[model samples]
Target: MASRVVRGGHALTEYLNAAKAAEPLYGDIQKHVLEAALRPSGRRQDVLHPSEMVKPDWCHLAAFHRLRLEVEPAEKRRTTFTRENIFQEGHETHTKWQRWLTEMGRLAGDWHCAVCDGYFWHDTTPAHCHECGAPSRCLTYAEVPLNAHPLRIGGTADGYSPQDAALIEIKTLGLGSLRYERPEYLERYTVPTDVGPVPDLTRLWRDFRRPLPSAVRQTQLYMYLASHFEDLPVDRTIFLYDFKSTQETKSFVVTYDESFSGPLIEAAAAIVDCVATDIAPRCNINSGSGCPSCLEFEEQK
Candidate 1:
């Protein structure tokens, strides 16, 4: 764990420029990421392993090392981007994200918070002051200190390092890009008439659900943790969108409280129950054309 010290102060703009120049090296990591992407929803252990990544789905295996996988149904696969192409295009935002962090390594001096316009002692992000709560960060550096922290992820002890993470988001637990609710045929068939038309929830989510269900669960868990054991100050996550690249990133916000216990596992059980009862076995995937929505409905013809 080495400290990133910038001379006199870090010239944020300069390092940012240099990182832009070094984009290709970052692009190479996308291949490894694509490996993770294709196999959505797995235990983090094998997914993050170096040997498992040897037979990369694409050449030379390069791209940011980590990403939330975006799985699409095999039937719906229409994108022509090679594994490399898609990952590279998709991973563009991640590259920028890492570069932003690497520049922090070059950070040098004390800076002011634009939001509260005051100084705080704690490192890392959320840039808030313990004294006065102000939601300010991603600060403009004036010889700032780039407090680099390791990304502690769940489902595995191993993940990208701080240096490598300066090139990636750190940890992500996600399945296919489009989260589906497997259709419920038995329930619809067994039940009688007007219990309200069992709606097609799929059509409702035609657009990308940019927000993660993980976040929702995180929110609920934080609520439970705060109520039961300690008062944890949960910060709402934010999205950073790039109009130029048409890329977007869900910014990382990590926090903890005085009661330095391990992550709350209790929240996971509730989430699993909800998924099993409400989401799993529910199907939303359907033909957008005027055709009948369900394969079952079409088959009974």
Candidate 2:
């Protein structure tokens, strides 16, 4: 039997609920943010691939990406008048963020492509396409239909390089000591029942023990399929940094195999089909969390 500590309505449960509720709203925010980021280019005719088109469930992921880029120099200091800066404030808290981004941009200047299209390097070498003149295009998103499932699988990858023929997934971590826990760690951690007060380390450890939480892992899997099926050599890397101590953690790398892509695509298609058919998808949050738009609809019912 599952332990009481592993029961539903635990902190993990609440966290998943909040994540679910934020999904649609985050998608909206992402659409706005990405549009803002791309607006200065004035490339209206630059068509979005099916996966690149923002979906109703993409808000959270988009917000995270926006926050990450907003802290990068090329994006932060590009120009206050740019669409990326439309909602940014020049306040004290943001000032440091802006400065950090600027400094990082300077340090990373040589790594960027001269073509100015939006491709960035994930390796020590610069990303360039000899045949295309454009720095390798990363498949930011892709929409593909799977036969096993009736719905279209919408997916977004971190980055891709046609030059090197590589697919890269980027993960960022903010200031903290790093430790990789095994699956057994889930059995060791306990979820507290009382809500009065929680220890910081306990909370962190509990969070660490939580699995990839099905939905998030599935999304990543979908992204993998979207990029890998196109014949890109897939890779994953983590960028771990400690904000408080300004220390860097380990940068781990992994390569993906093509055999995994087809199954993931099928899974993504199944998920999309479930969503389209009004069937409650087997996600962390079946009822949809506190997304304001979703909430309004719920209230009406």
Give RMSD to native, each candidate. Answer: 19.6, 15.9
Give lDDT tens digits, candidate 2, residues 61-119. Answer: 22222222232112211221222332352122233432343334311211333354344
lDDT of each: 0.31, 0.34
User: What TM-score would each prediction reach against the true structure?
Assistant: 0.25, 0.33
Q: Please give the RMSD of candidate 2 to the true structure.
A: 15.9
Best by TM-score: 2
lDDT of 1 by residue, 20-139 (tens): 545776543533343333333443421222222221131111111121121211222122214335445445544454346435652222344666667643324334444456554434
Count of backbone clashes for each model? 21, 11
TM-score, candidate 1, is: 0.25
